[model samples]
Target: MHLLPSNLIIFPNWLQPEELLYLDLERVIKTIATHPDSNKIILFIDTTSIYEEDADLVVSSVLMNLLLLEDLDVTEEYEISLLGNADRIEWESIVSCIHARIILENENQELLTSFLVKNIPSYKVEDLSNIPLGQLVFNLSKKLFLEERWKEAITQYQKLLEMQSGDADIYWNLSHCYRHLNLLDEYFNTLQQGIKLYPTHERLHFSLIIDFRQNGRIQEAILSADHAAKCFPDDYTFQLLKYLTVPSIYDSQAEISFYRQRYTQGLQNLIQRTSLKTTEEQNSALAGIGRLTNFFLSYQAQNDIDLQRQYGNLVHEIMAVNYPQWCVPLSMSKLQPNNKIRIGYVSHYLHSYSGTLWLTGWLRHSNHESFQIYCYYTGNEPDPITKQFQEYSDAFHHIPDNLPAACEQIIVDKLHILVFPEIGMNPQTMQMAGLRLAPVQCVAWGHPVTTGLPTIDYFLSSELMEPKNAQEHYSEKLIRLPNIGVSYPKPYIPPVIKTRSDFQLPDDAVIYLCCQAPFKYLPQYDFIFAEIAHCVPQAKFLFLRGTLLQPRLKGAFAAIGLNSEDYCVFLSIPERLDYLMINLLSDVYLDTFTWSGGNTTLEAIACNLPIVTCPGEFMRGRHSDSFLKMLGVTDTIAENEAEYIEIAVKLGLDLAWRSTIAERMSQNHDRLFDDKACVVGLEAFYKQVCSKH
Candidate 1:
């Protein structure tokens, strides 16, 4: 059998089918028995797609077969070219077939050296700088990104950008690198440039909206969303982005007015646009009109259950149009007894934040034998509590921030049950929760409201936390657990204590601690604070400072005829101990109206502080009341706003009554802390729900 002796011979899968046919080869051999008269052999291997299993196997097999060609000339110059990423490949197998591993991507010899040491181990990689400029720079930049060398990646990508400015992916990635390096200006510039180059690019445009929102540039974010919608008028995702951009409520009073104005106008504009002749325009307008955040926030202010359900249906319809392709159901046979039921938990707060405090107990006591826990985290960074959550889970995935990627990963996991600790808090997670990625999906009361998503099967609530007909409040089946559906861990009191003097509080003054975030303080609730302050002459209302500045807070207080000087806004104390100490320093803990505190209330209880709470119609407004009830301290549980003010005044001024309440709290506080029984109820609930599904 005669074989061709070609100097530029490419592998079977490397070249195109046309190129293969043009070669007109007889029988392709892995190795050539080199003639004594053979000249220099330049072997080029296209390992670009070697990350694929088949390609890796083929390349490995071909290289191994080179040893079979014993008569092949060894003296002639043999050059090997590696086309793509070699860091992940088993380079030793291929390296043995060639003299040196030639990296066709990067010019940085040090990068090649480090990669060789870490990946191939003890083998050296040569940076072949003579390769094509665009391919070399693109690979080098990508390699830098994979290695998490952010600054280097930015430089390399920027260099590549000059050569191929039209590449949207490059711009997207380079902007990400700039973000990781905390170069906000560069990040903005890169996205702007990318959008200018590729105006219709959804990914880059979507990123601009996300970047602006994450950085607290709400107006810019809304504008970016508007730009995206205008650029891609028929794109459902951009339309969704526009709808999500301006939240009805905001963290600060300045933003509250700004957002309310924006959303109110935005909604009205959308409604007017809904009358447009184009069905596409009408659909977008209708979806915006029925957006969950705006509707839910509006219902919260007015307690309109009908409006809530109406908006929920609207959102469901919009989601069906936006994400029409539902995930295929997992096989029942996959749920084998010995295999253990795969229960996945998705949350952006798997870290040390107050949101994850109650969840830690369930994770800590998870039955590893009966259930396998998978945690998909979306928070910015993991903390000590995050480590604990990871320790208890069978698998811990730091979910990528991208919506589609996160949702795709959850779908690919084939979870028997997927739970979102809170869906409405994070827009990215909210987007994922709209997809049917599991056999069963549930949302806990971390957000303390219904998700309004059709994909969500259950609202995992606590029996103690909800009203008699709580099912009517939720779109999903309300699965009420025996207690507040989590076992609370005992609050950690750091040994170092803070005093009133440390916070510059007067010893004789009655301190009323309303420690809820600013947004939780509805303008309607400002009257209660003012009334309490007026009733107790020496009262000082201490609130945890949110994104709102003193001026905004002062304006809120001034609206109700209260002097700003009568209250103190405490900046967030990074030390948990300091926070607990501050709670201890207060005479009365006044829970916020409508959206009451959960972890904050528990912390006050643990510190034996008297909390005055006026329960509202919804479960969100009743958490503090529930905890107070659990502890058997209903003296501070008010029936109305007047009673709420009266209780707060009594606690603030009447030292004897306040002391008695504090004593009762001291005795009963243990009842609410670390109830492991709640964990058992939760596990049973999970089992029941999974079994039913």
Candidate 2:
């Protein structure tokens, strides 16, 4: 009956070992009564590992006894510490017996307030702010939402709805939680509920429309945007959302052309709409376009310079009107040779598994004395890579999601140069790229697409990745950095070894791994898989599971007289260790034809997997090809789609040839990784840009 130094405790379970169930309860109660002299009593239910039906009944019985004890000693503090999901507990059934509710992992006061408010007769919670229970819960939910604890935040928001208290903002936050958690069905349902209850809530309506577009429901997305535009004629954002909307996955290349034309027309319409608009009106519309980048357009494998320039100017006009002081080009005095150049990097991807994977080399090996490094991050998550950035930074600012505040802070730093490592991927970065925050503003190939912003002075790209005359493809002055344009660290090979069977893949099959996302696999290139299957009997293509786009590829196979179910394997995307193994086990790495792989291809190379890629028009479409060229292995580089399919089929049939190429890659990987020459070229380029400025 003695309480030990360890806080671990056991509970009764009637379902298992029923003969001792009675004795179990008796001993548990005896221990509690003996331990009660400390004036604190706790019933800890750690269901994270195991849960039984009798847990609630035992907790109830124990609580009932404890409450009776509390009557004898009213000052004894009683609590229930929940180590697992709080939802499984029947709180309503046992609320009367509880003095406090504790969620161990999530130590927040909201649960206590929730407990006190629900059990109104027995307990009371007071606050200096005098906020109501609903407001208190709302505030905590918002805090959790900002911290990206989606599930916990969802639980807090759901409490408001359960208590017959809800609002548009609550629903909006709930919808976002579900969205991040990939509960699309629940996400849509929450948005619908919010929209129906608060029909005129502009943001709620906007969220619904944006959700539709992002989910690949093109018709519904466009229709909702159009409807909202009509409802709020003054809100040009809704109209712009409709105008800029493109398909998440194209049915065919023809669809791409169709959307491209629509996009061009949309730009024209947007131009006229902003021509005479007031500054306030234009600024209000910035959110519509600024809230999203034209992300999907790069997948089409076409030159975006003209359209991008048009859109860039369109955005610039609005920014210029709204913030004329900031929009004006920055004035600068010529820097003396010995003065440390003040350089700034503004991005949302300064973390691992992001575009920073390439930018890290610059941050890691920069000339700290010559360059005063300033990293302004728009993301909150701080992983190992982010820590490296912080360690190297002269000043590190993890800016919240506030565009104006971020801009003002950067301007106050009076940076001589600003670099956006990646643009046209994140909306906030995209919008910020449209403004002239520094005297010499530049962007690198984070997204591998030209930003087209006139405010941008240069486009830093990889000489290896750029096609001949690549400047025609970009709106900014192009500066091609040497080699891969990154002093990329060699990929860390995990020691965990796995086989094909671990992923439920056939051990005997010739697996061609194409691990790109669903939208990246345009239907136009889906036939390439079927054609490879036509020649190689043992060919089995592996893809990441995306239910929505599976049918599109399946239908493409069907058109080619092949049943996709037989030749195609879709497994849920694996953890990082398994992803590396997928590349290692596969006979050939089939690169997505138009938009070539970046990090995945780098990983595949680390595994010595032979990559078959066809270079396309733009830099984004040429990552793997350039990587192969750097490795001195160009046998797998295809000139066209025909050559791409031929090379892929050859790699499948000729194992010896594939092995030779893989061997060559392994030997020359040194040429690809940890090449400090890129930093040298970049520093020289930086000096050149600054001198010109």
Candidate 3:
């Protein structure tokens, strides 16, 4: 076999059929024997030959042989080159192969570190005018991206886009390159162009939604998601996108319920379709189901355990199983004998939100001597809560940049137990958890669902949050905490109730209040409330206004006939603690379905305000149910629209019963306000995880 010169061995335009086959076979065997470093081997198949059946086979054979040589060490000095007639080959097949090879070769050190560095800069746009050369550029660019040479990757993607103008995939790749480079404007513009060009392309629209979200264009993201859902009602991605987008505009509970219903429908449809399909179709359906199942489990959302177990079994049957990725980085058995158990809590919600507010009590009281608390703060905002968390933890690391790297570093530090306080809600936090940052990873109460990712080991739950029978819905093992719920103290002082007269309301009216975010109020909720108002003619609905009372949001509410004084009252309170004052003025608290209240509900209960809650079908929707149960206020739990209205009316009419409940609730506030209990439970959970590790 004659070795071709590295520079002159460009793709040939034409060759005899037998000659090409022979050359391909020779290259395959040589590649096998030499095990040429991926960096040194530049296989250039003339996509022109890809259309010919035998030539296509030859090219595929060459690729297979090269892939087989992956684990073998071949001579590093000589490079392997394959020249194909691009005009004869099937362009799509050739492009797909090129993409696969680029991804695969990225794992080869010699190729990733040296060959990419050496050849990427040398290959210029002008040099790739020919079709085969252009394909080569695309492959190299993909390799650059895989290697994290983002700047060079952008340049390469740009060159390809310029050459293959209006190519949706190329444009999509360019958008990704721009995104990876943090060029937000260009990333979104490029994706929008791609969406315009390929309106039916679900992936492009999905990318647009994600980009819009990452760029902080929440409204645009929702709009894009809505458009996507309308366009592809049956597409799983569209359903997921709709589910994800709702939290930005509506209440978290409502968003969770809506998505969970969609997910269930999607999953059931997938399973039914799989049963009726051919083998190939079944395989595809299984893969789709796997993705959905994983998604549900990844975020600790409501899932069907039997469905997930079936999906997991199918996945295992189809794809070869390997040890979980987290186990690859560290020797778990070796680290068990260590004296100090390093416990790491991974969260993006360590700021002044519900997650931080709820978990801070626990973090503050974690046992520092037995369990070393490592706070991995993944959020961008470093609020007062984050500062408090840092001060409380034994070690605190802020990971606002390079999340995967930070996670990997944490894993390297050999933390015994890693806890994810929130997942699926925050991208960076999920990404970090996906990297497997600890030996024993547990998902706690950041969001009210399971993290479907395989990296997470346990779902930290109470009997109320996840019943043992429902364990199958989650991907992780159920690690139950003691008691009905996790508790947090009211750290800030409750603001004194301001008179309705002070806030410009009628002095004699019975106030019905909803302190939850306005976005959580669905159209159905508006109808329910309207019905409630029709029943209780004396009651004036009051809403605690903050960001939700923005002009546009208020206008939206007004359109639903909830305008100021007519059906609603928006009280703009400057401080969050003032919410207590607002609650005190109201005769009753109306909790929204789908998205129930968290901190606000707790505060309302603490203020002895009767909270009327409608429990939805999913875990997120049932939060208020659990809270009410824990507070021994099951009478406040409404099962449906009719029941909710009935409960409100009953509470409004029976002032004596309301007074008795209020007095009891004010006395029972101590049970829910046990800051000490939260601290103890959290410390125990941490200790247990460390001991197991």
User: Each candidate: what lDDT?
Assistant: 0.66, 0.75, 0.60
Per-residue lDDT of model 1, residues 1-693, tens digit only: 111122222333433453342232111222222322123334444444445565445544544444454333332334434445554454433332222223222223343454433332121122222333355456656766887878766766766666555488999999999988878999999999999998878889878886686565667888899898899877655665675455423544465566555555554454344333456754654444333244235423434345435444545554455555653444432556667878889887888777666887888877888888999887667888889888988898887565556666777777889988886666556656766778888888777777667678888888888888788888789987766767888786554366788877788889888787655666545656666767788888777655443555567668777786776556566666778888888888988888888889888888878999988788888898888888898989999998888888888878999999989988886688777777778788877766766
Candidate 2: C-alpha lDDT:
0.75
Could you arrange the candidates by TM-score from highest to lowest? 2, 1, 3
Highest-scoring model, TM-score: 2
The CA root-mean-square deviation of candidate 2, after full C-alpha superposition on the true structure, stands at 9.3
- Full candidate order by lDDT, most accurate first: 2, 1, 3
Best by lDDT: 2
**lDDT (tens digit, per residue) of candidate 3 on 1-693:** 232212112232334455655454444335434432233234443333344565557655554655575543333444444434433234333332232232221122332343322343333222322325356566767776777766756766776666566367777777887887768788889889888888887678878876565444667887898898788755644544554342333334455566556545655554443331345544443233323323323232334455444443433332222113443444453434546677777776778888657777666666666667788776678877888888888888887655446656686667777777766555456545554456677777656665556666787766554443656557788766655346576645455656767678776677888777554555445556666766677777777643343444345446656543465666767666566667777788888776577777777787788888877655566666777776777887887889988989877778898888788787776666654654566567766655565
In each prediction, how many residue pairs overlap at the backbone (N, C-alpha, C within less than 3 A)? 0, 0, 38
Worst 10 residues of 2 by lDDT: 120-129
Off by over 4 Å in 1: 1-299, 302-326, 329-339, 402-413, 546-562, 568-572
Residue 20, candidate 1: C-alpha displacement in angstroms: 60
Q: What's the true lDDT of residue 214 in model 1? A: 56
